[model samples]
Target: MPSSLPSTLLFLSAGIFLAITGTLDAITFLAVIGCAVCSLLTITERTELAYIGGLALISISLILQAVLESKCITCLKADTLILAAVICLTPFQNFKLPAQIMSAVMSVVMFFAVVTVVPVESESTDIKPHGFGQYLEVQETSGEKLTLNTAENPVLLFSPSCSACEKALNKVMEQDADGTKWKLVLSSSKEKDIKKANELLKRIGYTGTLYTYDWHGSVPIVIYTDENDSTIVSHSVDKTIPLL
Candidate 1:
């Protein structure tokens, strides 16, 4: 058995773990590649490759936590473990102890960083209260407060950060007609969130009214009132298309 086999296996396992738990984003792709390279270096017993690969893995992990603002506990744990393993496996003259200690410190810093940087409200389970025909008032981007017209039916509740919302909005725009009245409500009122929402609307050339509402629920929600005045809330874009 190769002396470096355990480290190689650890790196490969960490890479697979990250790929499974993470979204298909650029940062995640880089991290996965870093892990694979680290594993390959370990198997070849190249000290220089180990040093470079280990440094890359450390940087990638920190980027995932601090720069990209990933809050996945599993991801953080995997990163910490991978860092520690890399530090241990790297060939450093009389520096293994210090490297391991540094890895531990980094793990602590990263754990605190993830907890403190992400807001508590992001994890709140509170959902929107009103459903169908309820009289709800939302704030427009122009700073005007307006009530949603239940008679209009089919109000779209979306968030700027949601991919599903973006896809649904695209479909809504494609199917838009001359007399169609499309009402869109931004589900989050955070300044950055509102900015993102507006950017998306502008990019897609949406001219409809966008109101801001403080709601916590699965997005791309389609709310409408039936002939009997009952409110219907749907999460499917196809269900929303006919009404649009």
Candidate 2:
């Protein structure tokens, strides 16, 4: 085997590390390890095990998600990589018809798994905030900018002190961004909360800019605006935001 292949596989495995939720999502890292294991399996004639191994990792990821009630996009991607590698290799090609049939079944299953697991990012101008923001006319706690309903995309008012707020922030950062951009407002009263929230954002590797504010212990809030700057969804920061 070419040495470059292993390097390439590892490079692919690392693609998910760029996610801003790297600190919050352990499943993504697990997928990386699984990919590495598959890479090693490729060196053997039993490369077919790579698919099985990857499938097992995916299963475990899903199980973990079920128990935790959270999903990992990067982990699913890692499994998809393994499935693709298996399809390309097709170790059962020279085997008996029964074995080849089984391979086909596995391939089909993998295809469905990929389709089902990957999340679709919404670019639709109208998104459901799920009844959270109910037309709350609110001004920016710190800045001169006000948003009762603005053209801006969803903005998360992050608080460093609240654990619920942190979890909600993680979900928004990981699930919403598929590439949607948003700005961060440091809207908390306690200086410690602001400081902590900033540090958490940095650790999460959040892609968007953080808007620094002189405001101080306001609750976390999410403001969703339509193209007309009309408030559609308004949610305050808290652990409960995950339900939205």
List where candidate 2 sits over 4 angstroms from the true fold: 1-21, 24-30, 93-223, 226-244
Clashing pairs in 1: 132-231
TM-scores for all predictions: 0.52, 0.46
For model 1, how does the per-residue alpha-carbon lDDT over 1-244 read when each residue is reduced to its tens digit? Answer: 8867777787888889878765456766887888888888888876456655766676666664444232344455466667665655654424666656765676677667545432234333222354546456889877788888745756788866555577778888787722156678887666776886778788778877778888764566777776787666666556667766
Error of 1 at 28 (Å): 7.3
- The lDDT leader among the candidates is 1
lDDT: worst 10-residue window of model 1 = 118-127
Superposed Cα deviation of residue 121, candidate 2 (Å) = 5.0
Q: TM-score of the candidate numbered 2?
A: 0.46
Residue 71, model 1: Cα distance from true site in angstroms: 12
Error of 1 at 158 (Å): 0.7
Writing each residue's lDDT as its tens digit, candidate 2 over 22-107 gives 43435455666666666676555455565556556656755764453333444455445555565554544354465456557766
- lDDT of each model, Cα atoms only? 0.66, 0.50
